[model samples]
Target: MADAHRPDKDKEQDAVRHPAELVAFSKVKAGDTVIDVWPGKGYWSRLFSPVVGAKGKVYAYVPAEIVDMKSDPMGIAKAFAAEPGYGNIEAISDPLAQQPPPDMQNKFDVVWTFENYHDLHDSFMKGASVDGFNQAVFKLLKPGGYYIIVDHAAAKGQGLKNTEDLHRIEEATVKAEVEKAGFVLDEESKLLASTTDDHTLKVFDPAVKGKTDRFMLRFRKPAK
Candidate 1:
């Protein structure tokens, strides 16, 4: 381990893409609360642990629908939260629903669903009403808080028709659905956009896994 007094850059090191921009967009800071919705393996949660420091909290949610998959998604997050340095993070498991938990209402500074928004429409998720889910997310945020979404982009006209097969969604469909939930579209980033992706292959395909064209959207809860 390096010295506790290491330079900020050395302390802030990680392999995730555009970590700086993500932090900027989420507006996360010391003592703020946030959630990494369905945090598959807690990659973002780990990054957030120190940024939020001890006073803040990070909820690494594991949607009840995906818990039984071979990946054992929730196990990974739970183990990570049990580790030495990640005390600031917590593991939360619940079905995706329209109602925010009592303690979470108007409590989060940011609710991030990275590469997992399309799963909201997947078949196995109980109560996975995409619009209602978005509405629930709106309830989870504080006034002026942001709901940041990043997901694989499907073809322009396909909408959600291919979600089960391709595990992707149209960027426009994401925007329109979230807006209907009362969140305002604040910004869209092309940082992960890839014109080379043909949008035909499954997101898990070796040819395109991790390289699918993606969209990053930031939607804000009204301050009042």
Candidate 2:
């Protein structure tokens, strides 16, 4: 069920997010530190900030791989940090694939990426390694932590065939890649599933944009 205790501060930003229950899929509780990977404009970061409350923290990590790509990427994270209710949020950018500092190793309770996981396989994001990225995620998360991924879906078992053109990926590929880093597949959410999507057109197609078929996957670090 969707969390009913949402802060008034998050109502606006959280309303526009699709699936309406993505946060509920996360199961992140108060005082949990969450890492929002590839936080474009910090949308999820904004939503997570108030949920985690003053005792918790949210790290909006802008991948350094794209930091210099003419978009002035860091500007987005900086802007969110300056927002009124974001005191518990930290915007971080480094040369690695959103890896935290040494002092923060094994400190995050959750790490999530939404609508951006396919980009990690894009050729344009050169030198960015998915295995390296997941390994880093494994290192940063404490035992029993969670990693949630929501992204545009490609045809089953199609692998990376459409990653560049359609900006979508086969869910099986994602599972294989992530599980290689030792995370156990915990749960799956069909909240964003769409059968009308033929899985051929680019996610940007006007006909399917904003409603493209998507998959929400949750993986957990084992407690022992």
Measured by lDDT, the strongest candidate is 2
- Score candidate 1 by TM-score against the native: 0.89
lDDT of 1 by residue, 95-198 (tens): 77748768869988889888889988988786567787788889889999999999999998999998889999999999899999899999888887888999
lDDT digits (tens) for residues 1-224 of candidate 2 = 14353435446545335524888788777999998988877667877877898899998888788888777778878887777768888988765555557887889899999999999898878778888889889889989999999999999878999999999999999999999999999999887889999999999899888788999999998888
Candidate 1 local accuracy as lDDT? 0.83
Question: Which 10-residue span in candidate 1 carries the lowest summed lDDT?
Answer: 1-10
Q: In candidate 2, list every pair of residues with a backbone clash.
A: none
Q: How good is model 2 by TM-score?
A: 0.90
lDDT of 2: 0.84
